[model samples]
Target: MTYLGFYILMFLGYINQLFFVPKVAREKHRDGYVPLYDSFERFYLRYVYRRVRDCWNRPITSVPGAEVYVKERVTHDYGWSFEYTGREVKSLNLSSYNYLGFAESNGRCAQNAVRVIKEYGCASCTSRNELGNSDLQVKLEKLTARFLGVDDAIVFGMGFATNALNLPCLVSAGCLVISDEKNHASLILGLRLSGATIRVFKHNNTKHLEKVLREAIVSGQPKTRKPWKKVLIVVEGVYSMEGSIVHLPEIIAIKKKYKAYLYLDEAHSIGAIGPRGRGVVDYYDCDPNDVDVLMGTFTKSFGSAGGYIAGKKELIDYLRVAGHAGCYASSMSPPIIEQIITSMTIIMGEDGTDDGMRRITQLAKNTKYFRKRLHQIGVIIYGNDDSPVIPLLVYMFSKIGAVVRTLAERKIAVVGVGFPATPLMEGRIRFCLSAAHTKEQLDYVSLVLIYNYEKDSFFFSLFMSFNKTFPVPSMAALNSLFCYRVIIFFILD
Candidate 1:
């Protein structure tokens, strides 16, 4: 039945291409016009290209020393995409994913990175298998394994490429790959390109995952009773958009019961969770050996480029040779590797100072306080209470941009997420809280939100402009609503 549906869809698509689209000549001399190419160009210019011409590509500074500058972007009379208005404004940054506040130039990591650059220049200039591997790269790989409590590890030049290019090498045809529905785009692309039999379970639903696993195992491959060459389960430690943690323990139990290999992605969770910043495995107190492949990136908490795949010695050794990314992609630079090692050292408290501990402790506290304050103000938020990443719900799609722009106007930078990044009506503003964010910053954001919501300000007016007839809730009403939700969302649970 599934095969039949797939064929039907393919046939329909072919029909649409044949009948719905206009036919045209490739050579100008044949029909005096290249109709198809011209039509495509016109469609792109009229519909697709024109839309992006006015949005995106605006410049914003992300450096730490001074407040970040966002140059004013204006549409010129010629309809150019972007033109700077000679105006710059310093804005508070709340959009980046530097979770542990390590993306700074003044830290121990920066110092180490400088020394590394002096020794190794700017680039490795080649793939690891060729002339790219350096002593620093080897040291970084070892440090990664030690940090993740794995036997060995392999490094990749780019984080997204690490997953996209390696998954096919790890699992191929005749294998089965079970993935979370909300997994990152890179994972999705990897799974698609792997040529493996793929199935998606509901996000974070271990029960659903188990059911699918049971069915796949019982049925085996079609027309043959051969068991799958392998069954690999892929999931992320944290759902980046929703700020939800994976039910790792439950998933691990199911994987063990089914005798499947588990591949965990710790891109957002590593160095931001657990007592020693060891990642989800440590946070759950699970044996790292149970996880067949542990993947993570230094871009987040470690404040550097590149990624790693850490697991047993044999697996890392195999990947070193077989992972296409490591074989062809340019190796991570020595400076970047040293930066990560230095950051990991700080995270592990090997620097003999309590600064790392203090940052972690404060991050936890700030996350809790910020969530609680938003709850108190009757803001509908999504995610686990302790997660530093928070999503404030904006049920109306129109309000997403309005709210973000309003905050930006107030010198606060925020990211607005809407379809197709999320489902219709599930628009939100994702706030990434960092340890660098002071109490004053948090309080200011909270106050701004409350004030705007109360005054029916321009931002709030955008909601009304969208034909929303309902009255905006008053402060007292919001407080009462918050109290009610607290009871339902927390107290009952």
Candidate 2:
């Protein structure tokens, strides 16, 4: 009976109209969580599925390969399609990190990944510090530097690992690290690992950065004190959540004025911003050499998997020797490396190819069109106009979740941002746009954002009130009988 009620609500949830907030309100705590985590146990636990449906409502019948699919795919034995009751959906992929649409077709680089796989098989034989370093790996560092407009560069196994290992090596107990409040989690982890005095300034506040730098200078140079060792100011070239960009020219000036080393992580901005998509520095016309440290990921714009740090030769040289992730982790696979290397040729404007630049402009155009439409309908969009990452600020987390599910029913794929990923009160629905996304698909998403917001408010309010009245305990109470199953699941489902 419990399973029966659960399936019924789930059916309603996944169907059209509004069902998410009321269902999630019953399942997740007021804080937005539920237990029953282990994979084996989850089999019996038919969840209040919060996964956003990005593919248009067509059933995905078959997946051709990575990032490529046959339309209306049903059997997602792999890739984006999933076989649910025997229907196929060629999921229109918007949640993916492939920014340049390079992965959508079979290209030279895509074939290269396969060719390398045939040559090297799978997996790196050892860590970069040991037998794993290949000749191609060495060439990538130099190629990345030339492409990024920097003096030198070093590739990492992944973006998170780059920060995780580099932060500790660069900062120590005596140093002070000033970071933007909205910097990525990997950077936050790096700061935490550095054991330095960490002070968070307002996001993109140059004045506050100066104030902190002044305080650090004063504190470090006291009577009978030691000379200031170093200060590092970290900010993302582009923020992920709101799809906003930092004021780079000002940040660069401030960092120089304070004589502090600047760390710019261009995770989102790399393939999306600037004239040729070189990122914030390019947007501002600042010399890439002026930046003391620069890091970015290939997951998004590059349409590959990995990360890198490019800067002065000495710094890159030191990081290569001292960086923990560089030393300990397996070197990136030959295939993935080839993908990035091939991507760099196109991204660097070599061979007179402006395809990447053209794509960035197209993405910006689509984003503006969608965001403007939402604004016209009185839907608030968070972040800058040019960014494809648009956030719809909805205070209720469950509603954000429900709206994602609601939009999915409409064949629009979107994701929710709330709880630990974002502040609890700032819960929102995040629409991560890719270059391959069509105008029609985005138009549907823009409309659905407004449609679901109005449709779910009533359900959201009811569930919010219900949860406040009677909070849930562990699953231990769930299997037991309830006088009113409707009332219980609506409150504790």
Candidate 3:
């Protein structure tokens, strides 16, 4: 049915394109000019994506806390363009990655950030190797190293660039990179730029990873059959899209057994998981030294910008000189660095307050409660119980837009994801849980989900059919028939 739906949509799209070209696609100068985009890309953008474009890239007018004020907009020509309605709707925020709830207008982090801005101004004005590197950058690197239980660390202005720019410095053409299938685009881009021979293992499946590693070791290079210069096993602490946590301990064992290097990207998990909020390594009580490289971003739990790569002092020293970011990209702003330093200090209890621990505990509590309630609600949610990133599967493309719009209308904001971010049939609404969210807020969300489930006869009937068919339908089975057609109808009408 999923494939059928896609094919039908594509067929309709092609038919529409035959008779009409979108205004955006029309060329002003066609004198021996080459088209910049593929026809299929344009078709998908104009027909498939345009139908539900209003559900994404929403403008938020206020802090992305437990609640956010989303600016309203409307489109006159399908989704070709939009105009602001001059209205902002305050909605429950399940969209932002503010895991520890540090994204705020007023707080210790915010206040410190403000002070730093006044003291150092906004921009660093140069690269780290140039005049841009500040005392704040040095302090941040030291703090980040301590936070991750590593020897030393280096900071970059952008999270994505941290991975994309550094990997080439770490590996090259003859190197073998065994990455998780669900690894982020940044990691993929980095590995590609590194010119390494890349192989993908099943997502979160340690056995498959071990299998792939063994095969790569035995096979060597394609033609020469020479041994690889180095082997790097890359995996995420928490996969953002799938909401799955990495099997870190098992992978570390595999890496040791194979004498391979492990690169752990903790972008989503750092300061969001474990008893100490130290990330996957802490969550599993593993020694930080077991992993060769530790990379993380401050954008999530810390509510700051920039990223860090933590490892041994030798690695950090090498990267400072060899990495592209340190040489070319501007250094992290003083204010952003301060935000990280302050938030991290709070997390480590260096500020002489249990506030950081309280937030971590609250986040874990909220995650467990939310996941439990969602499971009881009979929706198919992906990821481990402890992970704050939860993906509630809606399955169909049309349903993704419907759920986002419907939930927004009820004063709840969520992020809807589809291909090519995910497999075509696995479109979902990703809800990011945060410590700032109260039990009442979570309960309200659950109630809203339940209300939507019950109010729509299409979903209710589908649920009943599942009950009759399976006798005891698992979450996946129950989710197989769930549809948002009724909600879509209400929106279209």
Candidate 4:
């Protein structure tokens, strides 16, 4: 057959299947879950789960920046060469968590990374305990300790593993871990790995946290009334998903009252909040000593990899000998360690300029301005006023794809978050403001919101859904049906 004829045949076949397949799939989807023993279950999995999908996981940028091009994924073939040519279009970036805009490549951090890469090569050769402790690593630990006003600090190769692996060393079977209901997945996993009895309090609710702590302390274990070996209160300085700041002062008060050790995860707030970007301890003017363990990652604000656990010298020493991650995981590369060190020095004003302060100021300004503009445009946004992360509600499952694709078409880059990152009806588009974003870029976002606000567009629908004043459309009923079914079939199973 001729090449043109073959292509024509393929197109026609796809057109036929597109119409017929969806109707059948929607019927099966609406009918609900197929029993495990039924033969049709395999057909349901193949048709519903595999065939029905959206254009996600596409490469959105050449580098991390305020603007960049993205490759569009073809819905059917799952091929790369469909919409993306060699050239990339510039799109405003509100997706990356580069809060202080330190994630840039051509800055001092990059220069330091290059210098270290040339001097020490790429990998650290082995784990920290197994011939991987370099002079640069030691320098980073000391600098981190000094920066956080702690006696000492220990570094881990991976941020997620730092929490998951170290918790086992910190707490054991008889311990009780009181965590925020909306704490990140890593903290939840860490608590699970520690084999501790876990109790959750409502997110950012000091009263609820106190109540839980009081009950845990008084009631003791399930029935025996034996006191817990250790009671650790785990919470984030800032909730990444909600963009809300933790009520650190109140939490610390509760921790003190209960004689509980407080573990503060400053992953998002470390390099992003505070007048000096020193995190919640600085932001709230709380005593750093009040926090038993201060955990943070370098990826968000430092523009590097790895994580750190900072506390008293004794705890640092104990973790060095006991923490499985530091002992088993590969050490951070010299380049990454130097990158973090360089970023830290800049933040500490050791680079001999007010650049760090300027960055923090600019980030704060941008966050405030963007949020104010969003509020003025009459869109419901989640997070604190000072928070760099802003999430706009987009409740319906269908609108998640529609809104994301529409924004992409408008040359705006943002992340569409859905279950199980949030509840099924609470899906949203997350925007991370950075110091790199200019006034004009922020202005454009406001313009977009205002333009759609007046019309009966997706943004209008979203705003109405969030406001609670406007009634949800009957269309939401159809959307919820599929959303619930998918949740049950995939998550509950």
Candidate 5:
């Protein structure tokens, strides 16, 4: 059924393009210039993606707390462009990665951030190796190392750049990288730029990883049959898209067996998982030193910007000069650095209160309760029971847009995913649970999903009953049908 829906949309897209010239094709300025986008990319963006584009990149006017005010907008020509509706929809925020609920304006974290901004200005305005490095950066690096239980750590201005820029310094020609199949784009880009031979293993499948490692060991360099310089196994602590937790202990064992170094990216896991909010290593009760490189971002759990790489002091010293980011990218803003430091201090319970542990406990409770509720509601959700990143499968492309749009209308904000971010048949809505969300708020969201699911199932059956001989409906037809269903939803309310 999922494939049928997706193919019908694609078929209609092809037919539409065959008969009429697209707006992109009619542009006069590119007489001799090469096309900026791939042919199919342009086609997908126009006919397939445009219908559902409004579901993403929603502008929010308030702090992305448990609740947020989303700026409302409307499109006159499909999703080609949009204009503000001069209204803001106050919605329950399940979109932002504010796991610990520290993304507030009046809290200690925010206050510290503001104070630092006043004292140190906004940005460092230079690279770490240049004049940009500050006392906050040094202090944060030390605190990050202590938090992760590592010898030393280096901080970077951007999370994505932390991986993209550092990986090249760690591995280059003659080295091999074994990465998870569902690894983030940043990891993929880093591995690619590193000029290393890359091998992909099944997502969270430790056995496949071990097999790949064994094969690589036996095969050695592609044609020369010579031993590789070094092998690095890179996996995320929590996969952002699939919501799956990595089998860190098993992978650590595999890395040891194969004499491979481990690079664990805890971008989504740090301060979001484990009893201490210390990430996967803590969750599994594994020694931090088992993993060679510990990378994490402050964006998700800490409610700040920047990323850090924690490892041995030798590694940190090498990266300070070898990594592109330390050499070229501007140092992290002082305010952002202060935000992380303050957040980390709270999480470490260094502020003479149990606030950090309370948040961690609350997040775990929320994750388990939400997952259990989602299962009871009969929706297929991905990931482990403890993972806070919950991906509820919607399956159909049209339904992805429908669920997101309808939920937003119900004052519940959610993020929808579809190809090429996910497999076409596995489109889903990812709901990021946070500690700040009360049980009442969660109950409301659950009720909305349950009601929406019941309506969606009924309409889906009706649509599926159409005769096979009838022509497949276009994207617009499917969207209109869903819109009508949304209207009925509100009317029945």
Candidate 6:
């Protein structure tokens, strides 16, 4: 048969079956769980998640940013590409928690790790409560508290598991934990596990927080025999999703007015904000002592894999042997422990290079540059301009999903926020900037983003119409060229 005839036959055959296949797939999608077919779930996944999956249907390989080794950092980093995200794509790695870009190094730190391996022999095989408690771990906690300006601190293996088990251990059913509506999932799960009376305030709404605090205080007046001894106000120093900062001063005032314990999660803020990058607390010039309990994760900014909680020595001392998770979970590896010490030294301004100090300045400049260029193009930005985590908002959820898949072709990496992550109409592409991103790279990325934004309004409208009538394309001819829509995040900040 002629080549043209074969093409004609294949097109017709596909068209003839398209009707029955979609119908059957839709019916079965509602009933069956397709391992790889994720679209059929009860609730849809975010655009970025779906886009990454759709783009790499079989297996996605990643191109390395470096040739050698080091830490578990963000994005298509050279160190981690031999590394995570099996797709060999050259991307800026917007999804990683390496907020401060310390993961890209192995020089002084790697040498130390090798030395520690020879000294410690690589394993703290038992929990801290068990034989695993070493002098290093003890001194590490003390050093962390001093560096963070808190009274005491305790380090743990898993950030999520730390909270999943800690919150309940601290608060009881009688205590009312006033939580921020936008707190991380770990906080939510921990609150639920604790079986405490949870009151969610409007996200970053000090007035709302005050109202809840007042209500709790008032209710404890007469009939309440316990008189509500403790009120823990929970909020993040920097919100992970939007990169928005908390108004700590106002929140602190409200906490004081109501006599509540303010728990600030400095997850994304530490090593990225404040004097010498001491996190948001320093940025605000607020006394670290004012904050009742400070919890931060080393996975972010710090180039390690653990979490810590710092507060009054008495409280920390109680939590050490008191918490079940800490007593049972394996201690953080000697390598991570050593890395934390080195990383803290770098960020705390003990090092000569002053790289940590410069990183914060670079990130601030990059963030402003990206926001300014995007704003000039009239692209909506969410969160503070000073923040490294920027969100470009897109109001439509379904089409926002399509844009996530499209941006990859531009060689830019972005994450999408939709549905469960944000409100129904709040869909965005989260652009995480880093110190590692050079001015030229950012300049190019900004221009490409502008080009996408300029055509976005018209492109999404047209793509949605075509996609409605077409298949998502079989084996997206990676080596071939075609057109798709790209979505960026939209935020009011």
Q: What is the TM-score of each candidate against the true structure?
A: 0.83, 0.75, 0.92, 0.82, 0.91, 0.77
User: Would you list the C-alpha lDDT of every candidate in the order shown?
Assistant: 0.78, 0.69, 0.90, 0.80, 0.89, 0.70
The better candidate by TM-score, 1 or 5, is 5
* Backbone clash numbers for all candidates listed: 0, 25, 0, 2, 0, 23
RMSD to truth, every model: 8.9, 12.7, 5.1, 11.2, 7.3, 11.5
Better model by TM-score: candidate 4 vs candidate 6:
4
Model 5 off-target regions past 4 Å? 25-35, 456-493
- Higher-lDDT candidate of 2 and 5: 5
Winner of 1 and 6 under lDDT: 1
Q: Which ranges of candidate 3 are over 4 A from the true structure? A: 27-35, 456-493
Single out the weakest 10-residue window by summed lDDT for candidate 2: 472-481
User: Hey, what RMSD does candidate 3 come out at?
Assistant: 5.1
Tens digit per residue, CA lDDT, model 3, 357-439: 99999999999999888887788899999999999998887888889988999999999999889987898999999999999
lDDT of 2: 0.69
* Model 4: per-residue Cα lDDT over 27-94, one tens digit each: 33435765434544433333322332443455865656666567655544532124445556578888
Q: Candidate 6's residue-wise lDDT over 1-493, tens digit each?
A: 2334334534554564455432222333445653654442411222223333432222223322211121222335211123344335555555555666767545666677678888887887888788887777887898888888878999988888778778888787677899999999999999899877788999888888898878877776335546764678989988978779999999999888777888889888888777678888889999888898888888877767888889899879888878876678988788778878887887777877787677778777777887776665466778887788888887564345556656666666666676567775576778777776777777676656644544554554554455443222122321111244322232222
Cα distance off (Å), candidate 5, residue 32: 9.5
Question: Per-residue lDDT of 4-76 in model 2, one digit per residue for the tens?
Answer: 5445645654463233323222334536654546542332222232232322243333322222332433344
Which lDDT tens digits does candidate 1 get at residues 67-148?
Answer: 4677777776423345678898788777777777888868677888889789889897888788888888888888888888
Question: Ten-residue segment with the worst summed lDDT in candidate 3?
Answer: 469-478
Would you list the rank order by lDDT, best first?
Answer: 3, 5, 4, 1, 6, 2
Q: Which 10 consecutive residues of model 4 have the lowest summed lDDT?
A: 469-478
